[model samples]
Target: MTTAVITFSPQGLKVMQRIASHMAVDQYLHQAIAAPPGVTPFERVVALTGEIFSRYEGLVYVAPCGVVVRAIAPLVDSKLRDPAVVCLDVGARHAMSVLSGHEGGANDLAIAVANITGAEPVISTTTEAVKDLIVGIGCRKGKSAADIVTAVTTALAGLELPLERVRLLATADVKAQEAGLLEAAAQLNIPLRVIDSDLIRHSTRPFGHSEFVASHVQLPAVSEPAALLAGRRTSLLLQKTAFNGITVAIARENCPSLA
Candidate 1:
């Protein structure tokens, strides 16, 4: 998704710079800019916001909530069509999802911004408040889509979690182009996230490993690391399980309850 970060003061600009770097490291597409000198930044943000509302999926404004709300007022439409708008204090102490909290991803953006800037994210979305499950999978070179689906479903069933409880499916970067994996993700209606092999190895010690897989892929394991990386947690709810040439793992992260 495309994102834009606009700031008013120098402090906000500094925070925006940090946010940009963080987003880039996480492979997020983003644009960052400060308002021009001598002109009112709020006015510039307002003008640019009108265009960004349609052009970008997310908007980050580092200024007061009032300024952001007023600036985007004219372009405000239904939440379904509006871009996710996140407002941060000038000091970068708080990141607030002011509009389009769920469907537009403002709440998730807030949490990511908070992780980068060490600020508290103020997200009020109800669904976002619930913890999401991440499912990680590894399959044979030419596994069938049906086999992949069966492996994932069996893993979730072991944990007594329904398929709808899963929010994301992750696998090693090598599997990013796997037709079976992609097809299974499409059938399940969840995002298929690909993680770099090195990042996966460094994420956490694999719950299970195979010397054969290590020789071929140069990674200790695939499913366990993919789950930990996507869930941002160290432990797994279910360790690697192999069935019919498909391996699956499950992990959960505790999301902060809405206050």
Candidate 2:
């Protein structure tokens, strides 16, 4: 579905034109309608434009005035798929992403448009820290939940490790409680450990309980050990070239409580 940009003034048209020039022509559906001053509230213009594209999926509305902003308020709450609503002043001084940013890719798109139009991009969320390959592993609402579960299960098994041993499952904590890792875990009879930033920092092993603590826990070095255990369920075997008789094994164990 093409992203929709609705505007009322010639100045707004210029802003949309600049945005379109930078992006694919088919990506945007630009509607330049003339609204006379004091004839209709800005809100009514947004509502009317929204109603025209109500049946289409992935429609993003951008308006340039406060009155039009107020008019678009109701449409903001409507049950539409992939709706990205943004507003900018007629002068193209600032652009605000008011709704459906992260999942809808609005923030990124807004920044792109802002750069082209010389408007400020208002992004609030901080970027994800400790970069790793992020796999989207959950089912979205209004879709087949089982299909998602099956796909995740297949990916997990293909990794060649006991499913229970895979730690650091990333997802919304609350969503994890409902429709996240539980189904995949049950299907494979493996425990799925949910993790966030705090856990990722302290925990050495990404899988089941581990007792073996590395003498030093540092990056680049720690990544090697993690790579070794990526697909294996057992402890890693390390050999010392100097001492032929001595060998080192790293494994996860239960942590002892101070109490």
Candidate 3:
């Protein structure tokens, strides 16, 4: 899903630059401040937000939370239809999920941005205690978003687990910009993480091998290794499995039982 990052100050611009390096977002700055290359200037955030509110899937504010709230208050609609909104302070210490925390994916979007900015992610939407499940996926190029959703849902269903326990979706870096993967993550309201191909290729973690992948993509495997590599002290919960043209695997961070 497409996103826009907007800021009100020079300090915020610096934070925006850091975010741009890692995520794909259209950049915007206040009209009074001179914008760096590729960043657009807006006279008023409220007006601009109103105009583009429906165009983007997410809006990240590198400004005060109050200002962000005021600017978006008028455009605020339903959680299911509203764009994901996240706020980061100029110092970049916190990434807050301001709107659409569930249906529209602000919770996961904030986490993804926080991961990039090295900020703490703030999500208030209550669920069962967080679980560290990572779902790894691989798909044929140009697959539709449904293809990805099906693969992930099917994998999770086998365990009778809900989406809340899942932390993120992991895939090889080559699939970072895959349209299907991106939209599927947005649709599922789960963060999508891209593991570097070099890391996946060099990983010693024992997962099933795919001759088709070795011959075609030149990697030992994609799904299982991606899940294994995405979390800390992770162990495989599910091995690689094929769903039509997509492949899926599941991994969880190894923590002692609370029970």
Using lDDT as the measure, the top candidate is 3
Task: Write one digit per residue (lDDT tens) for candidate 1, span 52-148.
Answer: 6797888888888998899899998899989888898978778899999888888767766765675656766666446478888988798978889
Model 2 misses residue 17 by how many Å?
1.8
For each predicted model, how many residue pairs clash, with residues at least 3 apart or on different chains? Answer: 0, 11, 0
Local distance difference test scores for all models: 0.75, 0.41, 0.86
User: Regarding TM-score, does 1 or 2 come out ahead?
Assistant: 1
TM-scores of the models, in the order given: 0.62, 0.38, 0.59
lDDT per residue for candidate 3 within 1-259, as digits (tens), equals 7999999889999999999998799999998899988999999988998988999999999999999999999988899899999999999878999999888888878878876775757777765125668999988888889988988998899988877788878888777788999999989977787676787777888998888888877888889998998776788988999999899999987756522
Which parts of model 2 are misplaced by more than 4 Å? 25-44, 53-62, 78-82, 125-259
When sorted by lDDT, best at the front, the candidate numbers are 3, 1, 2
Model 2 lDDT per residue over 60-166, tens place: 34454465457556666543343655666657766676556656555545554554565655644333111122222322333333554555445544444343443
Query: Candidate 1, after superposition: displacement of residue 165 in Å?
Result: 2.2
Best by TM-score: 1
